[model samples]
Target chain A: MKTTLIFLVIFCTSIANAQTLEVGLRVQKTQEMYWENGVSAQFSFAKFKPEQFFLGLDYVTSRLGTAYQSNAIKQDSYLLSGSWLFNKNKPYHIVTRFNMGYFYSDLEEDMFAAIPNTSFLVSPEVGLKYNFKKMPISLNLGVGFYIITAKEGYSPGTLQPLYYHLDLYYSILKTRKK
Target chain B: MKKISFLFIYILVTISFSCSGPTITDDLLDGEVVFDPSLYNPEQFLVSAKYPIPTPADLNKHIILAVHGYTATTFEWQEFQDWSVTPSYRISQVLLGGHGRDYNAFKNSTWEDWRSSITSEYEKLIALGYTRISLVGSSTGGTLLLELVNSGYFNNHLHPKNIFLVDPIVVPSNKLQTLVGIIGPMIVYVETDQTAAENNYWYRFRPYETINELNNVMSIVRKGLENGMTLPSGTYLKVFHSLHDPVASTTSSVLIYKGLKTSSGSKIEVQLIYSDIHVFTRLNLRTKVTLLQKNNQLDVFNQIANKLN
Candidate 1:
């Protein structure tokens, strides 16, 4: 996991120029999904169609909610995604995204080590993004399905297949001019 | 940026408020009794109260003790009790300890207390000389039945002729259910999204301590499944599950099939219904019902009835 993060950081930073970096807070709900709150960071390549398309990373968890605070269940989802913005100049753009990721759950019991703790995740989503004309923030709402491949009883029962999420983003450190 | 920050704050506030609210209730143990007299009154449900000695007619007939799931009461099995009109068999509704009473009573109950009810009922029937006995449990009740078998409780007592499980929840389908150990203390009780009508029977709020106890039993049973368990000699077991049970996953049935074995060293029987509800046998309180749903319940009922014959 450390190696993957280091690799992602190095790769995204190397192409800093001509890239649009945005950091945001994400709130999501799947079909019967518990309230999951998290941080999202995405860097869109400047040279690779500017803001029209981008590679992104997001981390969402249930740590901040009553679900986690009350010791009901805690979950974390780490996703790497590719997104496309049609008609980038429009204040409102159609966004299509595909995310590949990992899901981890802590059962808090030593006896459950043999039970499934992690799963490979893939999600395909479509939604609308509205960028304020004057402010540096963007708001996005989309729905996605996690194609969890784990077998029955091995995966978390709450992590069902379908979900919907809302993203609130802000422009962060700009890419250096080439 | 200020406007955006303000917007961000507004969005955060809105989303945070959108979280599902907690289920708070007056504890049942505050002043109320632990058991529901109306439900447990021998004049009403406990057939044993009416017939202390088996009528020659009741003698030797198959008697099934029906057990309900966690946070549930005898209502879970009431439909079956009502449906069984045949003279060949009868239903004994066993109320788990701390159930069918009040929130305080349920909140203070333990899993062992829950299992004790089943044991006591079984013992009573055994004492009455009911040699042909079977057990039918739904969800947690099913888990308790399996625990009894895994712990060899059946070996010391009279072996049940058959054990029927309906969506026994070894593996919960709700993803958050698994994390109770870590998230339980901070969120003391998990609230159910139940209607007022449903709340009349099931506990709308679940206490953390009771949840912990449930996890303990589930862990014990899950490990037993992993290690494998054998039915008591001469006992038969069959599991029935919904194809899409939202509460208890159908995979639980699969685990039971893989882990539990007959005394003859053969695989136990399992049937997967093509329905999509948990405890498909209970049709009341459901908002919608299809022909398939009714058929699913009848199929299991018929199967159990057939075994009795």
Candidate 2:
């Protein structure tokens, strides 16, 4: 309840200041050779500034699937991140993001003598958003380095894995009347 | 750049080494035990035994006590029965309490009922004059066996000779039980398709309240450990797990292996089977074949039989 309230407060504050909201779905595949594929939906609130900069808050919920032996590995994650657009006007926008999140996997039940648990992932990402000149659509390509930490189990230590994502979105609601 | 290049090289080498490591052959045996559905037909796909025997014999020579996961039944062990000959040991397919019977019976039973049932089976085997026992348990059963040993139930001069654990539920924390207790039983459908049946026989687990019972089972296991009893001396413990099994992760095996005490007199071996399935039902065939060829299982039985002789 406390966490939800804090989140709601931040969301309300962000919406009041930003006045612009964007929501879209994203497909991501981990660049780590041993990892699997993932998909997520992201909701962002941002405000464009006079200095050609943009600041936003993003919440993403994602699912990842992997194959192990004869079984399928699935995980669900929720991430909250802050994004800063280095340049907003160019056809390609460069954005930097920092994220903190929790991930739950069904496999945790098997840990012997340990508590069933969840993992925390902290990541910093850099990406490019290429806007289609004529259409209100854009292609986003990004890479993030995540410090994966497991809680309450025999984790294989903190692994820094490379994650890559691509998203294509068509604006359903424009921030401006034009 | 130099450090980065070295790290890349190190990773490549590690991958290569793992791939080239001794191919853990499932080839522990040759030939197959074809399943004749007619020979051992299940009376009802799901029904309780009308005539419950107070003491079931070691009906087969190569006996394996097969225990299922939560809300599971004896039928889950049927897949394994087909892969072997009428061997030297009788396989005891135990239907845990609150399962394999009327579903309503579960609501009235506690986790203690399940524990008592397993202990009774163990005592029955001992009374039958079978000196050697091997346990093949999965998920919840795995935890139960570990607890059984820690509790000193098997600590006497004679006890189970070996244990085979598949995805034992050993966790570092207890919070998941609460969450699972809240939501685990909402699922009611059981997969009846052939493939689904083959893969997941115990599809319908007990409700969330039962999850609390499972938590009780865990507590008993933990208490046994604290009491200073260890897995029986010279007993062999082998664990097999898949990397991607969503129901039971590979980490479970790792944790159990870590907690298990290995005195010089005891032999414990842990093998993490790399597979993509929740349960390695397919490996059942390989296990039977391996036992048949090496006759390792026979040798164990023969040692017992010789004493009888």
Candidate 3:
């Protein structure tokens, strides 16, 4: 996993012109399921579409949301996405993205070890993003649907297909000027 | 964007136009024409009714109450009763309230109403001096049993010796089941796609209100499991689920395993059958049956029988 993360980082940073690295929060809620909140980070390049394209990573868990100090199932998700922005000049732009990820829920007991609590995830998303030019903040909203290939009982029940998410990104490093 | 909007509107309009719910009819089991015999002649279906005044020999044998699922009647357990010819144990096929009646009754019933028959039969058995009692629930029936456990129903009553769940639906395989509240108005009721013979035993039309009721009981049970529950002292539980169940997901059993504990706090037993159908035990009216299916049914029946003995 570490090697894949390193490879992705290197590949994304070398894509066009390594410029800015934006980091902040991602809050996601699955339809009729869990509310998972976690961190999101994206890297931007100056050329080859400049701010229009991005490579990002997200890590979210129910531990920070519904399961906190409660008996709700504890689950975690990790995602890698490549996003494209439309109408790059506007403060608000349309966002289209594809994400590949993994999901796992803690059953918390060894006896339940045989139960399916993990899954592979693939999703396509579309939403809108609003950027505050003066501040280092951007608000992004997206609706995504996972294409679940595993049969019903073979996959985790909480890993539902549809989800809505809001991401708040802070510019940790500014991109190079065109 | 324009095309997507147009398509969404078109689909909504189409469904809105097609939303004429069913009315009572003789051909449909949801109508007032037919009813489960258990409602009238409980003497035949329920053991409690047959032996309201049990002899010493009757009290010594174990009595296992069999509860059926949503929209189902006592016929669901008719096979088990016929299969078990031994006098060591008896099967009480309890027909849920408002079930095997008419459409209006089913539509108007709540989850609590559906559970009344099980409790009523249990209480009757207890009152008759039957000390050794167990329970076996299938599909929604299993979920109802879970609710009973969480609600402390057995605390005051005689604790059951064992509880067996088959294809219990804590989580429905259909994801859209949770969205009944939103789409329920647009679609007043859901029609069943069952064989002619099957219609006599189960409700043909499912009202949106009853769907929500199912959702309610399922939600309650799921929450209770998450909060952790214990069986009554000396009581045990065993869950049987089809690995590829198309109605009740196997996750239901998984959650039950993770949440419920034996009276002694040990993990309950679970067996996952490699089958594609739900409630593998009920093969009486099925159009076709396979050898594997029969074996699966026999396997569970024997295990339950062994436990009861």
Candidate 4:
């Protein structure tokens, strides 16, 4: 179990090569649940997969989307992910990624303090990314299933397992003049 | 070719098992029970049925329609009826349509069909000149009540005086519950592990079709909540949820608080019970009852009874 955890940590997170920083927006929807929209940021290091590998952080919440002057629960998710591109130098690439994060849904009242409103988030995702060659912009479409860490009723009800996201990223720097 | 044949045979056998139904001797509600007792004699279970003609005094008494969850019959709220020994209010246990019966009848029923039982009973009381009427629903029963409010069902009818929800399910705790369509064909139906006494009250076998209906109503209510819903003028709603309900998530109550508003645009009251049982108000026929559980049940019961009086 420890080895699996370590392997997952290594496979899904920070390892470096070529340097390019991308910051953007994420539009997310949980299956049959809430619409959570937020921001995303990614960066990669110097040699070994170059721009093909990226480590990212994302923060999404219903407050900005479905809960905006609406009745949806106010919840937030913070995720750290490692994504690997299937193609080396292409305008379009398939992306396989893994993420680990935390989730919380504010019950707003003190009476429900004991109810499980927090959970550790773990998910594996697969998607497609499209890069605009002339402009340093990219559009990504991804779907992910959260690996539920607790018993069914022990997790926050609004934190459903299946979700899809579409992200738009703008490259702030070149592939580090490789 | 031999391996392919073996795989095909295996798949066929699995499918056969999936579609298999219980035998007559299974001693399960799916095969053993003809129908819920309330269906056979609603007059004995529903106040509206028993007192079709109000005595003017009967019309003044508050009528609380008690609705049970998915697969549950009028038996779920039997304890409340037995406990309420006062004339200030009455209990009408309306069995949802298509429940407490054989598997086929259950498989053929829709959520709308299930909710009709509640509507028909409510309409009957209204037609009988019972002006003081309230509603109490548990689990999916609670969901249906909220749906009624969300869909504006009370617009044409008399407004309910008070609505009490116990462990309503807006979002299911079982994450795979969302994927029933994909897995339903292979699974056909689900059999719960319950005692014999429970079998006489709740459906032992849950058909995929009914599960789909459950999902459909939940989806409708959730979307409506997203858009926001309000109670009728002079109506009051309060949701009581178990802190760690195994069947329905506690977040359901949170949604109820956020989405449903009282007549004056104020947030509805929501209380998280200290127990873990899905419907803490129903302790009858349970295998083991804890003191705390009993206290929780009595607490809600007394609270409801007090409000009625």
Candidate 5:
């Protein structure tokens, strides 16, 4: 994992020297009230340029309470994403991102035994982020829809109904290069 | 160049913002029905006997036992009442053990316990004077039914007149057994619209508590697989599988079709539906099209009813 992270860091840095890259730790409080704190590093290949875009990755894990009678549940999700900044001319840039990733969790037996529980989710998402020029931070607001398929030993012929998620993230390093 | 960039940004923003249409509010229920988890007996996992009273007073009609996939109660079939408008057949939704009422019942249960619960339901239906009985198992229930049929237990109990499986899991023991052994027991959390926190459900039963029972269940299911056991001849078996279901994969249905098809005649028919979701019942039009194109449960049941007559 360390080696991979290093390789990614070097690869992202080599994209464009004129770009401003920010590597920092982020903590996200999901709608579920569980805190997903992780290290997320982002590299903007063409900051302030017309044809500018950014690539980012985030790994988050959290344990939250279930509506069911069980005590607590744990989930590990990895996100790989790329976003295109459409309007760099304005102080507030409109950025749209597409994320492709997977999530794994170990559900309680009572829950798994009862419903056709899906352990993994494979889906894509699109979101919008608004970067403010006055502050060194950006506020990201986005929504995602995912369909989870059941795995083996799980209830088949059952659908994990389409679920929607609304997220808010505060960027730690949103700065323009000199 | 600036003008071109501005146009590109305007188009992208328009497309992104316009992608999602206004949320539909028609399906919203007028009143909220607060589900009290404590009212029902946890042991009686099936639906209340009063809600879905079996149709047809004649006990001689072919009995069809329907089991819902995980995390769901017999209430899942409440929507099917309109679709199953036939009188010659009776459908009983079997609730697996450790579901419906109490969430903790899963702590003491194994896969065998669930199978036993289903078998007992079958026995109850048979004892009620139904001569011809068909098993229609969905999701995990489908796995249980397949394992039971493969075990040769049902052969003596009345010879399953037919078996209808929807997105069954025929090969769970091989793929998930090892993971359970290592993990001991894990739980997954599901988020609800009303709840602030996600609900946690166990992924596997505790090893020390139900290890022996699980091993026994695995061994029995495995033996049936190794012996090349197939459903008895004259026993009509139909499978309705979803091509895009995330939980029960299309491969699972294919395996069941291969394992349970008898050589005597065309006793097995497999229908693969291509859809955007897993279970088809909850989906809207496009998803339902995928489900119908693959296999219609009502159609399968009617065909079996005709043959029996």
Candidate 6:
């Protein structure tokens, strides 16, 4: 376990060398859903397209406040996202994002292991972003819905589909000088 | 560019308000009566009412309190009363606090008021010295039952013999239902696309206030389920759900099973039937009833009857 942890950290730091990378924290407030808090890391591989396109990844958990602290239904989600920004030079940009992810929730009971409570999730989002000129920082606000594809009784009941989030990002690596 | 941006904002606001549907008249009693007025004339509907006295024979039989869903009246369980041929049990159909009247009554009533009706009847049965008592709730009724268990109401009061839930709305099957809290202000009331017969029993128009109340209580019970609840000692529970309930999600049963345990820490009982309708146990006055629907109702009825016997 110790060796695996060291290797995982080295791998994550190496990936930060991508042309443009932004690592951030995300706070999400769901509509009639639970409060989920998580960390976000995003990078743009488009040396040609520059800031217009980006690849993002996020891991969110409700365990911080509601699930692990209060309720037994602890949920962890890891999402991979692709995004498009309509304007390149403007400080403020209109953004659309598509995300795909895997979700797992544990009821903390041995008897419920038979229920299919985990699911694959797909979501589409729309948001606005502001990039600060002086400071290498950005903030984004987005709303999205999970297009739950699971049949009835196969998905977790607490995992509703609609949510809005705020992302505060610090620029780790700037877009390659063009 | 400014013109385009302004137009976009205007359209978004317009759509938000448009989705709320329509508003009900402010007058709380502005609707036609659906059930026989004579039934509540002397308050015979309420088991606590002095008009109807339970004889020694009535007290000997098991008492089952039947609760309906949101915006519904006692008529939701009227079919059960009509079809129950055996004298082994008696059905006390309860009209939720704000229900069975006009639209205004529901608009102003809170969830607590709606729950009071069930508690009142249960206390009445106990006061009359009845030992065998059970509860059957459809939709929101089931949510309230779960709330009762989570609050430890039974541990303090008389422990019920059994609790049966049919298509409870812990998690709604309709995705749009969750948005009611956000869209409620613009759409003061939601209109139901129901036939005249259905309207007579269920409120044709649902007030946003009541919808919020339902959401509030459902959220409480849902959190309880997530944390897991222990059934009151000596009480039994069984949840019956349709495979594809269009109103209440089938996941509701799954949550109950996962989150709730019997007094002895055993998993609660659950049964899933094959049907696509909401409240599958209420079979009266529905359009285009199918063989499967009838069978679904009988299946649950037999289960409850056997338990009573």
Best by TM-score: 4
Which rank order by DockQ, best down to worst?
Answer: 4, 3, 6, 1, 5, 2
Candidate 4 per-residue lDDT over residues B137-158, each given as its tens digit: 9999999999999889999999
Scored against the true structure, residue B72 in model 2 reaches a CA lDDT of 61
For model 6, residues B1-309, the per-residue Cα lDDT tens digits are 999999788778757865654444433223644443424562545554632577887778887888989877787777777778997887777777887777667778999998998998898889887888999999999999898898888877888999999989887766656888876766767787777677667788887878899989988898898788999888889999877777787767777887899999998898877777789988788888898899888888888888887
lDDT (0 to 1) per candidate: 0.77, 0.51, 0.86, 0.86, 0.50, 0.79
Q: What are the C-alpha RMSDs, in order, of all predicted structures?
A: 12.0, 18.2, 3.7, 4.9, 17.4, 5.1
TM-scores of chain B alone in all candidate structures, in the order given: 0.88, 0.62, 0.93, 0.93, 0.65, 0.88
- TM-score of model 6 vs. true structure: 0.82
Better of 5 and 6 by DockQ: 6
Q: Candidates ranked by TM-score, best first?
A: 4, 3, 6, 1, 2, 5
Candidate 4 has which clashing residue pairs, if any?
Answer: A17-A45, A17-A46, A17-A47, A18-A45, A18-A46
Candidate 5 wrong stretches, greater than 4 Å: A1-178, B1-57, B171-178, B185-223, B263-267, B282-309
- The residue pairs that clash in candidate 3, if any, are none
**DockQ for candidate 1:** 0.08
Between candidates 3 and 4, the TM-score winner: 4
Interface RMSD of each candidate, angstroms, one decimal: 10.4, 13.5, 2.5, 1.2, 15.3, 3.8
Off by over 4 Å in 3: A2-20, A63-75, A84-94, A104-118, A132-134, A149-154, B1-19, B23-25
Q: After superposition, how far is residue B187 of candidate 5 from its true place, in Å?
A: 6.0
Q: List where candidate 4 sits over 4 angstroms from the true fold.
A: A1-18, A176-178, B1-26
- Model 1 lDDT at residue B201: 71
User: Candidate 3: lDDT over CA atoms?
Assistant: 0.86
DockQ comparisons of all candidates to the true complex: 0.08, 0.04, 0.43, 0.60, 0.05, 0.27
